[model samples]
Target chain A: MADTVATPKAHGHVEHHDVDYLHDGSLLSWLTTVDHKKLGVMYLWSVLFMFFLGGVFALLVRLELFAPGKQFMDAETYNKVFTLHGAIMVFLFIIPSIPAALGNFVLPIMLGAKDVAFPRLNLASFWIYVVGALIAVTAMVTGGVDTGWTFYTPYSTTTDGSVALMTFAAFVLGFSSILTGVNFIATVHKLRAPGMGWFRMPLFIWGMYSTAIIQVLATPVLAITLLLLIMERTFGVGVFDPKLGGDPVLFQHFFWFYSHPAVYIMILPGMAIISEVVPTMSQKTFFGYKATAFSSVAIAIVSFVVWGHHMFTSGQSQLAGAIFSFLTFLVGIPSAIKVFNWITTMYKGSISLQAPMLYALMFLILFGIGGLTGLFLGAMSVDIHLHDTYFVVAHFHYVMMGSTAIAFLAGLHYWWPKMFGRMYNESAARVSAVLVFIGFNTTFLPQFLLGSRGMPRRYYNYLPEFQFLHQVSTVGSWILGLGFVIMAGYLFASLRKKMDAPANPWHGRSLEWQIPSPPITHNFHEVPVVTTEPYDYYRPFEPSVKGHH
Target chain B: MWLFLATEILMFGGLFVGYGLMQSVYPEAWIAGHHHLDRIMGAINTVFLLCSSFTMVMAVHYASTNNKGKTIMNLLLTLGFAGGFLVIKYFEYAHKFHDGLLPGRFFSYHGGGPAEQAMFFGFYFCMTGLHGIHVLIGMILISWITLRTMKGEFSSAYYTPVDLVGLYWHLVDLIWIYLFPLLYLVN
Candidate 1:
C-alpha cells in the first residue's frame, strides 16, 4: 500500500513547497518550531556548544596534569574542573549527541513518516534539555560541584559547593531523556512506512530502538536516584547517608544500576552510527544483519546486570561480585559480534576511505581497546588493583570519547552534506580524522600503564616516575584538541558554500538518502514505500519516490 | 502511554527498593514508625484513590461509548476523589509536623522509639510525598480532560486523552495499593 504523509502545514505565512526546513522559518520560527528537523538542528547546535565547553574542561584537567603538583590549579580547583568535565560530557553532550540531535533529524525521515509520533513532545524535550543544561552551567559557574559526576553519597551529602543544584540539573536532564525515549518508541512502533517491517529496517534504527529502551527504563531510575540524592542532602533524608543509619554502598548500587545501563545508552547510539557507516563505506550489504541487529538488543539487556562490576571493590558481596563479573563478560560477546560483523562486511567489498569511513575504522580500533580493557577490569582480582587508578580513567575515555565521540564525528561527517546541503573539503577532513585517531590513542594509551603502575586518579600530585606518562598524556590531549580545531574550521567553512550536495551522497541505500539534501520540512512530499532492506546493495537501488536519478 | 507509565513505575520502583532495603536495615525503626502513621487515615486515602481509579475507568468507557455527559460526570467524580485523597494526605502531614515527626535532623517527637526512626520517617515522607504529588498531577490532568470532554473535543472515535489519563490514574492507584500495606499495616 502506498503511504502518503501530509506535508506539515506552513508555520504561519504560506510559502512555496520548494522551501527546505532551514529556510522555511525565521529565527523566531525556530524557537517555536514543532518540526522534527528544525528541533534536531537546534539540539545539534546546543549539544555541539556543550561539547566545546566539556572539551575545554577536559583540556584544563589535562593541562594541570602535565607536570603534576599544581601546574595551574590547586587541588580544590582541579577537583571541580574534572567533575565539570565528566558531568558536562556525560550529561550535556554524549547522551543527547546521537539520539537527540542526529536521531531527531533522521529517525522520522528514515521511517518515511511526516514527523515523530509526538512532535510537540519532541520540542518540549529539547527545551527541557536547554533548561537543564543552563541550570548545570549555572551550577558550574557559581562555585561548581567537586563531588565528581558520580555524586556518591556521604561525600556528596557533605560537600558544600552547589552539589544539589548540579544533581537537580541531572534530574531534569533525565526527564528530557525519558521524553525523547517515549517519542522514539512511539515513532518506531507506530510511524514506520507501510512496508518497513521490523527486520527490514536499518540497523541504525535497531541500535536507536535498543538505546531508547534503556533510556526509558534506566533513566527514570537515575531521575529518582538524583532526586533522592537532593533530598538526602537538603532534607537529611537519611537514605543514602551513612551517618544517618543509611548505607553509602547502597548509593553505589543505585547509581551504577542506572549508570551501567547508561553507558550502554551512550555507546549503543555510537554503535548504531558505525553499523550504518561500515556497510555504506564497504558498498556491500551488512554481512550479518540479523546478528548485528539482535546484538544491540542483547547488549541493552546485559547492561543492567553488569552495574555490580563497577562496585566490585566497593564492599559488595563476593557472590554478587562474581555474578556481576560473569554478567559483565556477557557484554563482550554481543560487542565482539558487532565488531566481527563490521570487519566481515568490509572484507571483500569495494571500500572507500572517506572521512566518515576513516572515523568508522577508527571506532573499530578504539572500541576494540576500550571493550577488551573492560574485561580486565571486570575480573574482580584485577579490578581490586586498578579500582580508582588512571587505568579506569583510560578505559572509559576509550569507550566514551575514542569510540563514541569518534563515531559521532563519523556520522556528522557522513551526514554533513545531507544535513546542511554542503560538502566539506574531503582531504582536509581526512587529515583531521587521522590526527584525531592518533591524538586519541596517544592521550589514553599511556594511562593504561599509569593505572597499572598505581597512579591513582583524582590526585592533585603524583610521584616523579608517573610524571613522564602524565606529560605524555597531556601532549596527546593537545594533539587531540588541535585535530578537533581543524575539524571545526573546515566544517563551519563548508556552511559558507552554497547547497552543492546531491540527494544521495555516498550512494547510501537508507530511506534518509532517498530524500533531497537538507530535506524538506516534511521530509518526503509523499511517504516512500519500502520494498527492499535498507542495506541491500546487491539489489538494484529502487527509487521509492519520483524525481530521483 | 504504556511506555510512559513504564518510566513512572521504574521511578517509583527505585524508591520502593530503597525503602525495603532501609526497612531491613532498621526493622525496629520501621516497625515503630508504622505505629505513628494513622492506619485509618491511610485506609481512607487508599479507598479514595481506589474509587477515583474506578471513576477514571468509567470516564474512559463513557468517552468511547459517546456518552459525553456521563464521561464528564465520571471525570468530575474522579477529580473529587483525588482531591479528597490529597486533603486527607494534608491532614496526615500536618499532624506529623505538629508532633515534630519529621525526617532526619528534624525528628523531635516528645515520645520516641529509636533514633533510626528518623530515617524511617524520611522514607515515609519521601514515598508518600512523591505519591501525593502524583495524585495532585492526576487531578490536574483529570481536570484538563474533563474540560475537553465538555468542549465536545472527544467522542467514540477519538478519546485518547481520556484513555491515557485513565491509565495514569490506575498507576497512581496501584502504587498506593503497595504503599498502604508497606507503610501503614506491615508489621
Candidate 2:
C-alpha cells in the first residue's frame, strides 16, 4: 500500500516569507525583546564572558597554590584573588549560566508562546544584571574586597577593605536575580499555549518552574542578608559584630539561609536542560515524566531545609545538624530518580551520539559523582572532616562545573542552529566537549584526594606535601581554559557564515521546532496549539514541515 | 503585587529577626538601647507614614475613576507626608549626632559604659537610615504619579501604576509600625 501526503504546489514558492529577522529599529526594541531566543542568546554571551573572567581569577589562585609557600603573591593579594573567584563564579557565573541563558531562550519556544509574559521587564532585568555586574567589577578595581563571597561577619565589619561597596554591589545583584525570578514565575504560570496541559509541558519548563520558585522565595533572604552586611559594615551596626555584643553566628544563619538553596538554584536549570536533550536525542519519551518533573519541585522544597548542612560545623545544635543531614540525604533521592529516569530513557531506543548527547552522557556520569559525594558531606562526621577542605571544593565543582557548565554547553550546541540560524562545526564541538570532560576531571579529582588528606581550601599558601595535586589541578585548568576558548571561537565563527538551518534541525518534537529558524519578532505568526505530549516517539515520525526545501 | 509586598516583609523580617535574637540574648542592652531612641520622633514618623499611606490609597481611588485633579491632589498629599517624615528624621539624627552617640570605635560619650550605648545608637541609625531611604523613594514615586496624573495618563482600565504605588505606600507604613516598637517602645 502506498501512503499519500499533502504536498505543496510545485511552483517553487513557499507559502510564507521570513518575517523581519532584525528586531525593530528602536533602542527599546532591543531592550525589550522578550523573544525567548534573543533573551537566551543574551544570557549565553553575558554568562560566557563572566565564566572566562572567573576562570582567569581561578587560574591566578591555582598558580599561587602551585607549589605553596606564597610563590606568587602575598596573603592579602591571594585573599583578593580567591575571594573574587568565589564571588564572581557564584554570583555572576554559575547562578545565571544555564537557566537565564539556555532556559530563557528555549522555555517560551518549547511552551509555544510569542514571548514571556512581561517583555519589557525581561529587558529591564537584563540591564539591571549588567549594572549590578559592573558595580561588582568596579569594587574589585577600587581596593578589592577580601571577606570572601560569604561575607562572614565580625571580620567583614572590622576589615579595612571595600566590604560596604562590595556587599552593596551584591545586594543590587540580588534585586536583579529576584526580578528575573519573578518574571520567570509569571511567565510559566500565565503563558503556556492552548491544549498544552501542565503535565504535557517539557521537563525543562518544569525544572525552570521549580527553579523560579526557589529564586523568588529564597533570593530575597539573600538580599536582606547582604543588606544587613552592608549596614553592619558602613553604619557599624551591631547585628553581626561580636565585639558589639552581637552573635557572629547570626551572620552564618542569615547567609546560609539563602546560600544553601542557592546550590539547587545553580544546578536545577541545568538538570532541566538535560531533561529536554536526553529524551529527544535518545528518541524516547522520558520515562516517569511526571516523576521527573515533580523531582525538580521536590529538590527545590527539600533544598530549603537542608541548608543547615553547611552550618553543621559552625556551632549549630546537634539536633539541627542531624535534621539537616537527614534532609540533605532526602534531597538526594529526587536527584537519583532523575538520573535513573534519564538512563532509562536511553534504554532500547535510537540513541544518537550527537554533540548534545555527548554532553548529556557526561553530565549523568559527572553529576552522579557530584551528587553521591554530596551524601558523604551530608553525613555530619564526614562533613566535619572535609569541611572547608579541597574535598568540598572538588565536590561542588563536579556539580557546578561538570553538571551545570556541561548542560549549558549542551543547550548552546543543541539550540545553536535555532538561535543563530546557522550550524556550528559539529566535529570541533564534540572534541571540545571531550577535552572539557577530561580536563575538568584531572583538575578537580585530585582536589578531592587532597581534601581527604587534610588540605584546606581558601589558603594563599599550602604545605609542600600537597604540591603534586595542586600542580595537576593547575595544568587541568589550562586545558579546561583552552577547551572553552576553542568552543567560543567555533561558535563565534559560525555566526559569520550563511548556513541555513531547517526549522526542525534535529527532528525534535518540541514546539520550538515548529517555528522558523531565527524566529521572527513576536515569535510565531499564529500561536501554535500543542496537541501531543512532549517526546512522543511511539507513533511513526511525522515530519511536520509542509514541504522539503 | 502582593508578592512584592511579601518580599518587602521578608526583607524587614530579616532585620526583625536580628532585633529579636539580640533582645532575647541582651534584654538589658536592648532596653538600654531603646532609652537612647527619641520616641517623639519615632511617633511622628509613624503618623507621617500612615497619612502618606492614606493619601496614596486616595490617589489610587481617584486614578481608578479617571479623576485626574483628585489624583494629583492626593499624590501631592502623599509627597508632603513623605517630606514630613524625612524632616522629622533629620532632626532626630542631628540631635543624636550632637549627643555624641555615634557607632563603633568612633563612639564618644563620657557616660558610664558608652561603648554599650553605641550599639543601641548603631541599630537606631541603621534602621532609621534605611527607613529614610524608603521615604525618599516613596516621595519620588508620589512625584511621578502627580506628574502622570497631570498628563492624564492613567485610567480605570490601566491603573497598575496607581495600584502598585498604593502597595508600596502601604509597605512604607507597615515597616514604620514594626520600627516603632523595635526602636522606641522597648523600654
Candidate 3:
C-alpha cells in the first residue's frame, strides 16, 4: 500500500491555500470565524485564561490556609475566594476546556469533516461562555457571591452578597454548555465522513458524544435550579427555604441531579483525550475498544442515578441512601473498566514517553486514585464520616483537576503542533508534566489525610493539630502553580521560536494526522473516504491530501 | 433540536419533581391551592395552545409541500393562538395578583396556612411563568420563521428549521398539557 495519501488534485479548490488559519489573523476575522480550528484555538486560549484565573483564586485560598489562622484575609473574604475559585474553575474552565476547546479543534478534523454540523452554533457557544463568564465576573465585582458554588438554599437566600447575579450567570452559562452539547451531538450524528461508521469513529468522539448527552440532558436541570435559586433569593420563593414550608434538602436534590452527572461532563472528555493519547503513544489498537467506548456511555448513564449519593448525608432516606450508594459504585465500574482497558491497551505495546503520553499515564494513576476514593465516599456508612471533609474535596479535585484537567493539558500538548503549526520544546513539556503531577498530588494528598483526620473543607481557620497537613497542602499549591506557569512559558515560546510541525508528528493512525498542520481555513479540501479502521498500526495512515505541500 | 428538547424536558422535570415532592409533603395545602386556580381559564388556554399546535403543524406541512402562502397564513394563525394563550395567562395572573396570591413572601392568601399556600403558589408561578417564557420564546422563533417563509427561504427540500421550531412548540404544548391538570385540576 502506498504510504502517501492520494494527493487531492485541487479540483476547483476555490479557497486560497497560501495562508494558514493563524496568519490570516485580523480581529474581525477571528471574531466572526465560523471555522472550527480558529474557533477551537480561541476556545483554547480563552479557557486557559480562565483556568489560570481560577488558579489565582485557588492560590489565594491556599495562602489563606497556609497557617490556618486567617493569614491575611478575613473569614468572609476566604469564603468569597474559595467560592469564586470553585465556580470559575467548574463553570468557566474545566467543563468547557477539553470538549469545547480541544475537542472542537480535533473532532471535526479527525472525522475528516469540513466543519461541525452547526458551525455557527459552535461560535455562538464560545461567545455565550464568554458572556456568561463576564457576567459572573460582574457578580464577583458587585459584591462577590458568598453562597459557594453549590449555592445551597436558606443560607444562599439570606446571604448579602450578589447571589442572584451569580446564580443568573450560572444560569446563562448553562445555555453555553447546552448549545455546545447540541452542536457536538448533531455534528457526530450528521457530519462523519462517508466511510466512518459508529464504531470506526474515535473514542474521543464517543467520550464527547456521551458527554454531550449528559451536557444536554443534565445542564438544563442546573439552569432551572439556578433560576429557581435566583427566584428564591430575589423574590423569596419558598421551595428551598424551610421557613416557607419548603425543604432545604430538596435544593440538594435539584442541585446534585445536575451536578453529579456534571462530574461525568467534566471527566468524560479528558477520558476521551486519554483514549486518543494512549493508543497513539502505544502504537496499538486500544485494548477492548468497544468496551472502552461503551464505558463512556455507561459512565454517563450511571452518573445520573448516583446524584443521591451526594445527598446521603443531607438527611435523605436510608433506603434512598443505600440505593444511591450502590448506584455510585456502579458508576465507578465503568470508570474502572476504562482505566483497565487503557492499561491493557498499553500492555506489550510500543511505548513513546512523549509529554502527552506522560500526562496520560498520570491520568491513569490519578484518576484511579480519584475513582477508588469515590468508592470510599460512596459507601453510605463511610460517607457519613467523610462527608464534607477535605477527603471529599481532594477526591473531586483529583478526578476533575487531576484527570480531566491533566488530560486537557495532555491533549493540548499532543495537539499543539497541529493547532499552531509549530513544535514545543519536548523536554520542557516533559519537565512540566512531572512538575504538575508532583505539584497536584502534593497539594491534594495531604488533604485526604487531613480529611480522614476530621479536617473539614472550606474551613477558614484550622486548629493547630491539622496545621502541618494544611501547611503541606498549601506549599504543594505553589508547586502546582509553578508547574502551570512553566507550561505557559514553554507553550507561548512555541508560538514564536519553533520549526513548523508536520501533520503527523506523532505518526499515529488517526484522521487528524491526514490534514495539514495548523490546518487550512477549511479542514479538508474534499470529504475523505475513510476505509481503514481508526487505529490500524500496520500501515501509516497518510494525510487525505498528501500533495498539499 | 431533539437534544435541546431533552434539556428542556429535564428543566421542566426539575420543577415537576419539586411540585410532586411538595404536593406529597403538603397534600391538603396543594389541594386547597389548586382549587383557587380557575379551571375555566386553564381549559381555555389549553384549547388555545392545542389549536396553535395544530396550526403550527399545518404550517410545517404547507411549507414542506411548497405552499408558501398557506404556510405563512398558518404560521400567522398559530401566532394568533400563541398570543391568545398569553392574553389569557395575563388575565389569570392579574386575577391572582388582585387576590393577593403572589408567590413566596408576598403571598397573602391566609386561608390554608400562608407558608404552604405560598409554596404552592411558588411552584405554580415558577412552573407556569417559566413555561410562559418558553411560550414567548416559541412565538419569537415562529415569527422569525414566518418572516423567513414570507421571503421564500424554505420548501419541501429544506423545511428543517420549520420542523425543528415545530418540535419546540410541540414541547411547549406538551408541558402545558401536564401543567393544566397539575396546577388547575389537581384531583
Candidate 4:
C-alpha cells in the first residue's frame, strides 16, 4: 500500500501548472485571496511591520529609562509609549506572529490539503485582525491608552485616554483569534489526508490544536471582560470599579482568567516551532514524541487553573493564593518535559547550528530561565516582593519576546526557503542571532536584579541606585535593534535573488518538503497519504512526489 | 460549530460568574432587586424563548427531512417567538425605566431597599442586555436559514446551516432558562 501510494505518476504526468500562490494573484486578488499561502504571506508582512513598530516603541521606552529622571518625552508620554509598546507587541505582533502568519501557510500544506477548512473564514480573520489593528492605531494616535495592555480596572476606568476604543480594538482582535481557532480546529479535524492519523500528524499541529483550544475557550472571556469594562467606564456598571459597589480585585481575577491562558496561547505555538526545528536540525527523530505532544495539551489545560497566581499580591485570600501557587508550579512539570525532550532530541544526534537552529537553542535557554522565574513569582511569598516590579517585566519579556519571538524567527528562517524559494545570507543571519542573544541578555538580565532591589514596573522615573543597570539595559536595546536591522537587510536581499533553494533544503521528511519550494496555487498535486511518522529521520530519504507540474 | 458554541458559552460564563460573586457579596441587595423584576413577565419571555427553541429544532428536523415548506414555516414560527421574546423584554425594560430601576450610577429609584440595589440592576441589565443581543443575532441567523429554505437550498443531505442555527437557538434558550431563575426567582 505504501509502495502504491508513493508512485510519482500516481495521479497523471500532464499536470496543468498554475503559477505559485505568490505570483498567481494581482494586488486586488491578494487582498481578496482565500488561498492559505497568500493569506499567510500577507499576515507575515503585517506582523513583521507591527514588530518593527513595537520595537520602535520599546526603543523609546528603553531610551526614556536611560537616565531615568527626565528623557526627551515627559512621564505621561513615557506611560503612553510603554503602553503602546506592550499593546502593539502583544495584541498586534506576538499573538499572531507564529500561528496566524506561519501556521496559516504551513498547517494546510502540512495536512496535504489545498487550504484550511474554511478559507473564506480564514480570510475574514485576517481582515478582522487588520480592522482591529487599525482601530488600535487610531486609539494610539488619538489620546492613546495608558492603562497598560492588561487594562486593569479603576485606573482603566478612570484614565482619560481612548480606553474604550482601545479595549474595543482588543475586543475586535479577539474575534479574529476566535475565527482562526475555529478554522484551525475544523481543518485539523476534517482535512488531514488519507492515512494521516492524529499521532502521525506533525507536532506543530498538536501545538496549534492546543492553542486553538485556548483561543476558542479563553478569548471569549476576554471579549466579555473588555465589554464589561467598557460598560464599567461608560455606564458605571461597577463590576470592576471600587468607587462604585464593585471590587477592583474582581477585575484582576477576570483579566487574568483569560490572560493567564493567553500566555499559553502565545508560547505553545513557539514550542510547536521548536518541536519541528529541533528534530529537523538535529537530524534525529523527535524524542518522547507522545510526551512532547501531550505536554502541549497539558500545558494548555493547566494554564487555566493558574490565573490566580497573577493576583497573589492583589488581596486574594491565602487559601486561593496557596491553591493557585500550587497549580502554577504544576505547569512547570509539562513545560519541563518539553524542554527535556528537546534537549535529549539534540543529544548524540547530528546538530546543525543554522540560523533557525540557533534561535531554537536560544528558546531553550531563555524559556528555561523564563519558566523558572515564573515559578519564583508563582510562590506566594516571593511574588509579594517581586509583584509589579521590573522582575515581572523581565520575566514576561524573556518568555514573550525571548522565547516566542525567537521561535518565530527560527520558524521564519527555517521555512524562509520553502516560503519564498530563496535562502538568506547564512553568515549574516548567524551573526544577527548571536547579537540578539548578547543584546537580549544585556537588556533583560539586569532588570531581574533591578526588580529584586525594589524597582517597580511601569514607573516613569527611577532612583539613582537603579540608573546604572537601567543604562546598561538601554545600551543592550541598541545592539538588539542593530541585529534586527541586519536581519531585515539580508532577508529582503534574499527575495531579490532568483529562486535557488531545493524542495528539501534541510532534507526534512515532512510532506511539505515533498512538493515545490514555494508550493503552487493549490498546495499538492494530489493529497498525500501519510504512511509513516513525520519525524521518520532514520528511514532512507524517499521523496513521495505524487505528481509533477 | 461546537467550538464556536464553546466560545459563546465561555463568554456568557464570565458574566454568570461575575453575577454570582456580586450576588454573594450583596445578598440582601440581590433579593431586594429581584422584587422589582416581575416574575410573570420573565416567565412569559422564558416560555417564548423555550417555544422558539422547539420551533428551531422542528425547523432543523424538517430541513433534514427535505420538507421545505414545513422547514420554512417552523423557522418563521421560531422567528415570531424570538420576536415575541424581544417585545416582552422591551416592555420589561420600559417598566424598569418607569420605576427608575436602572443600573449603577443611573439608578434613580428612591424606593430602593439597599444602595447596592443599583449593582443588582447593573448585573441584571448587563446579563440580560448581552443575552438580548445574542437573541437578536439568533433571529438574524434564523431569518437567513429561513430565506435559504424558501429557495429550496437545504435538503436532507445538506441542512448544516439550519442545524447549526438550531444549536445556537437552543443555547440561547438554555442561557435564558438559567437567567430566569437566577434573576427573577431569587428565593
lDDT of 1: 0.89
A-chain TM-score per prediction?
0.96, 0.94, 0.96, 0.96
How accurate locally is residue A373 in candidate 3, as Cα lDDT from 0 to 100? 93
A120-181: candidate 4 lDDT, tens digit per residue:
99999999999999999999989998998999889999989999999999999999999999
Cα lDDT tens digits for candidate 1, A66-152: 885878789999999999999999999999999999999888888889999999999999999999999998898888999999999
Give the Cα error of residue A231 in candidate 4, in Å. 0.3
Model 3 Cα lDDT, one tens digit per residue, A36-74:
888888998889899889999999999999885867999
Candidate 1: tens digits of C-alpha lDDT, residues B1-187: 9999999999999999999998888889899999999999999988998998998999899999999999999999999998898888999999999999999888888796888888888889989999988988888899999999999999899998899889999999999999999999979
Name the runs in model 1 displaced over 4 angstroms: A1-17
**lDDT of candidate 4 over B52-109, digit per residue (tens):** 8898899888888888988889999999999999999999999999999999889999
Q: What's the lDDT for candidate 3?
A: 0.87
For each candidate in turn, the TM-score is: 0.97, 0.92, 0.96, 0.97
